[model samples]
Target: MIYADNAATTKISDKAFEKMLPFLQEQYGNASSQYSLGIKAKRAVEQARKQVAEAIGAQPAEITFTSGGSEANNWVLQGVTKLFKGEDIHIITSSIEHHSVLNVCRALETENIKVTYLQVNKNGLVLVDDVISAVKPNTKFVSIMLANNEIGTIQPIAEIGKYLHGKGILFHTDAVQAVGHIPVDINKLHVDFLSASAHKFNGAKGTGFLYKSASVDLPNLVFGGKQEHGYRAGTENVAGIVAAGYAIEENVKEMRKTAERLQAMVQTTVSEIRERIPDVWINGNAELRLPGTVNLGFNGVSGESLMNILDLKGVCVSTSSACNSGNDEPSHVLLALGVSEEQAKSAIRISYGKYNTIEEAEYVASAICDAYSKIKSAI
Candidate 1:
């Protein structure tokens, strides 16, 4: 099958699997135990933490491993709110955030905490001015995704981070889609917090990390064993963590070459589709998008139907965010970008990865064109 759904998840890399084998079998020990086996596991976890920290330009002590991106996001949001006693808590986020971030903000609303949902422009970008305008006195945090999972829009995170630097408002970005595929430096971005998942970058699932600035005082989201400096609780997934670190290191090592190739393939595919089909719209900022993502809207076809047809042709893709894949609602990101409901419903996202090839991209593009033609002809 031609897999074009890398943004949803990726096949685990062989290097990651190899690194995890020993930990899962021979060195199986709780990271918290004091035995020799446990010490080895503990050492591996710490080393993995350091690797993750270095990948994002953070200090080793600042990294907290979690179950995945959703948990990391929840921890950051709830931790910050709890630290402030849940009173006068206010947050600023974009309308295009994944449901993991949006739903948490929605839950905060029930507690009388105010939230400002910033809207995006025509290119599916949140302007720096819109963010500045949304900031209120009680706004304690700003949560935005570094790269959108569905539309591939890259936010002006460095600009936003600089704006919120000394305002006592923490900046947290969900970098799950941007980590291994793109260059990320916590210091350069000046972000207070960041979240990432392993599966998005060819690592094992159920493993992720949260980066907290040294100065940001955060409360514990999960209260139990002191797995992650008491910030996160539970037994550490040693095997998964090892695999995550290995996957990230390998990806970063080859990122420059892989990214350039994927960008070229995406450009070619999008151009071909638009050339073949009229009234097709590219739905994201062309200049500031992820190297491997192309979200497009066909004027008169349903995205769900298009996805179904593509799957039947052995090409995998998605409509809307994977987190809300089953939901029938029109894409919130597209609506935030000023797209009509009908247009939003007709958009599909094709994201690439290191394993995707030029041939696969061309095949998927042709399949999409064929699907659109058939669907149009049926009407």
Candidate 2:
């Protein structure tokens, strides 16, 4: 398959898989047990934590393992919201955030916490000034994604985080789509918390982490025996965590070389699409987007129809977030960027990864143009 859905998830790397095998077989042990095997497991977990921390320029103690990005986001949103009871709490977040943040904000509303959904520009960016204007005396926290999943619009998270510092308020970023794909320095961003998923960067599924600063105290989302320094509790997935560390280390080390190739492919694809197809709109900030994510709106064609055709052609792409797949509704992110529902429904997202080749990109782009032509002709 000429897979172009890297934004949805990535396949595990050979190195990560090989490292995981030993943990799952002979090295398997309960991290909480008091034995040699358990001690080995505990050491693996700590090493993974350190690797993850180094990847993001954070302290190892700040990293807390979780199921994935979703849980980490929920933990921060719910845990922080619960901190202030019988008092006014306001959260400022972008309208184009991943469902992890949006859904949690919806639940926060029912708990008497006020949430302000900041609007994005046509390029799907939240302005720093808007964030400042949205903050009020009751505004207790701010949560926004480092980069959008579907459109790949990189947010001005560092600016927002820096501004919100020393105001007695907390800042968190859902960096699931941005972490390994680009350079992420938690200290530089000035964020109180950051969330990331392993699978997005070619690690095993069902594994991820959260970075919480020492100053930002939060209630535990999972209740059980002490693990993750009592911040998160459960039997740690030693194998998955070990694989994550290896994957992230590899991804970060080779990011620049990989990014250059992907960017070249993206340019070729976009130039081809525009030259061959008519009236197609490129979503998100062109210059500020992720390496190989292309969200294109074909005026006279349906995205779902194009996706089905692509799948039949052995090419994999997506309309939006995998979490919101099958919903059949226009993307909330596109709508936030002032795209009409009809236009939003006609957009497709194509994301590339390390495994994708220039030849695959050319073929995918050609196939899309062919599909669009057929769909437009019929319409």
Candidate with the greatest lDDT versus the true structure: 2
Off by over 4 Å in 2: none
- The alpha-carbon root-mean-square deviation between model 1 and the true structure, to one decimal in Å, is 1.2
Model 1, 342: alpha-carbon shift in Å? 1.1
lDDT of 2: 0.92
In TM-score terms, candidate 2 sits at: 0.98
lDDT of 1 by residue, 21-126 (tens): 9998999999999999999999999998888988889998999989999999998887788888836878999898988899999998898889898888889888
What's the C-alpha lDDT at position 50 in model 1?
88
For candidate 2, lDDT tens digit of each residue in 1-379? 8999999999899999999898999999998889999999999999999999999998899899998999999999999888886789999999999888999999989888899999999999999999999999999999989999999999999899889996767999999999889999998999999999999999999999999997778897778889998877789999999999999999999999999989988988888898997578888898898997989998867899999999999999999899999998899998988988999999999999999999999999999998888887887
Question: For every candidate structure, what is the RMSD over all alpha carbons to the true structure, in angstroms?
Answer: 1.2, 0.9
User: Candidate 1 — which pairs collide?
Assistant: none
